[model samples]
Target: MDLQQLRYVVAVAETRNFTRAAERCLVVQSSLSHRIANLERELGVKLFARSSRRVELTSAGEAFLVGARECLTAADRAVADAAAATGVVRGTLAVGVIVTTAAVDVPEVLQRYRARHPDVRVLLRAGGSDELAAAVRRGDLDIAFLGLPEGARPPGVETLALDRDEHVLVVPTGHRLAGAARVTLLDIADETFVDFVAGTPARAQSDQAFAAAGLARDVAYEAGVAELITRLVARDLGVALLPSAFVRPLAAGDPELALVPVADGPRRVEYLAWGRFNPSPATRAMLDVLGVRGADPED
Candidate 1:
């Protein structure tokens, strides 16, 4: 019925527990319970089915949640728009990134953005490129940095290609293939590899290349982080094909690791993606900080 009641309902739904929701909302448990009870009585429908162990959203609640979130988003955006008119930006900016991205220095960019707009709250999340792109499309993220295979763009959003570079083969210093001038996929076809998880965009870069070469590799280990993959390679557990930008600095730091050029390697493209529709002022400011003023949200 009111914004307060809606907030309480959303909080409870997200936390799935009354006590935690109350704590998150910075309200006492009894007060939050009373407000939700009043709202249910007014609507003549139970929004939640409450049990001692957990609180579950009922069918009616599920339907209400969709509109409730939209209403809250609109309200917040209205306030932010009003503030923007007075030369101030105030809103939450949710950014998603992949762990292996090396095109843009994320922390430094965030620090600069924070310095310019201290009023805007920033939330950062780490995920696979595909997952982060989906979050941006779903309005869960305001912007995202993704590292996808060459020529593959994330669908349903506006994107800007940041960087494109080929992959390199990483090996342990003592390995036979280390210090090689250059190696092709055929050279490493029989060697065990440590690579990103199968089906991920990061993994696809190498997978597509090997498939095109008519070669199959044995991936001995699957790790999400590039650093972990490099660690496994350093121990001589396996060799890996990684983005040149990410592997270069890593090999420089670790004496046990060596970088070998891949003559026929897959290329990875880094992208900056955001929603195509009306962007919040905070999103615009972030784009400006990234040197993309009036960035076209179109492909």
Candidate 2:
């Protein structure tokens, strides 16, 4: 019935627990519970099926949440638009990125955005390209930086290809192929590999390349973070194929590793992705800071 009550319902639905939802909304647990109960009574529908161990949304809650989120988005946009008309940008800018993004310096960009619009709140999240792209489409993230295999782009969102880099082989300094100027898939087919977790976009980059060559690789170690993969390679666990730009800095670390170009390695394209229409003022400001627009090429 009210925006505050709607917010309480949404928070509870997202967190799936009264206590955590209250913590997120900066309220006491009992108050949050009472508000949601009052709203449920007003609507004459049970929104959540509550249990001591967990909270699950009823069928009604799932339907209600979609509208609730839209209402909040509209309300927030109205306020932000009003501020923008007066030449001030005020809103939350949620950005998502992959761990291996190398197109732009994220920290530096955030610093500049903060300095330019101190009134705006900035949020950053890290995830796989597919997940981040989905977040952008869902309006959960205002913008995202993604890395996908060559010629691939995130669907249902506006995207700009920022940079393209080939994957390079990462090996211990004393490894056999470390001295090689370049290698191909056939050359490394028998070598043990360290790679991203299976089914992830990062992992798929290499998987697609090898599959095209009709070769199979032995991925002995899997990690979510590129830094961890480099550490594993440094310890002689296995060599890895990773984006050259992402691997360069990791290879320069304490237990240094070597990078050899993979002649037939996968190429990854870094992209800036955002919702296709009516981005918030803060989101627009960020795009301006990045020197790009949704209408740019590859949109």
Best by lDDT: 1
- Please estimate how well model 2 matches the true structure, expressed as its whole-model Cα lDDT: 0.92
Query: What's the residue-level lDDT of 61 in candidate 1?
Result: 97
List per-prediction Cα lDDT, in the order shown.
Answer: 0.93, 0.92
| Candidate 2 ranges with C-alpha deviation above 4 Å | 28-30, 50-55
Candidate 2 lDDT by residue in tens digits, 1-299? 88988899899888899999999999999998999998889999999999999999999999999999899989988999999999999989999999999989999999999999999998889999999999999989999999999978889999888899999999999899988989999999999999999999999999999999999989999999998998898899999999999888877775559999998999999999999888889999999999985456474
**How would you encode candidate 1's per-residue C-alpha lDDT over 1-299 as one tens digit per residue?**
88888899999999999999999999999999999999999999999999889799999999999999999989889999999999999999999999988999999999999999999999999989999999999999999999988889999988998888999999999999887999999999999999999999999999999999999999989999999999999888999999999789878889999989999999988999988888899999999999877756443
Candidate 1 positional error at 176, Å: 0.6
Q: Candidate 1: where is the Cα deviation over 4 Å? A: 295-299
TM-score of each: 0.96, 0.92
Q: After aligning candidate 1 to the native by TM-score, how far in Å is the CA of 85 from where it should be?
A: 0.9
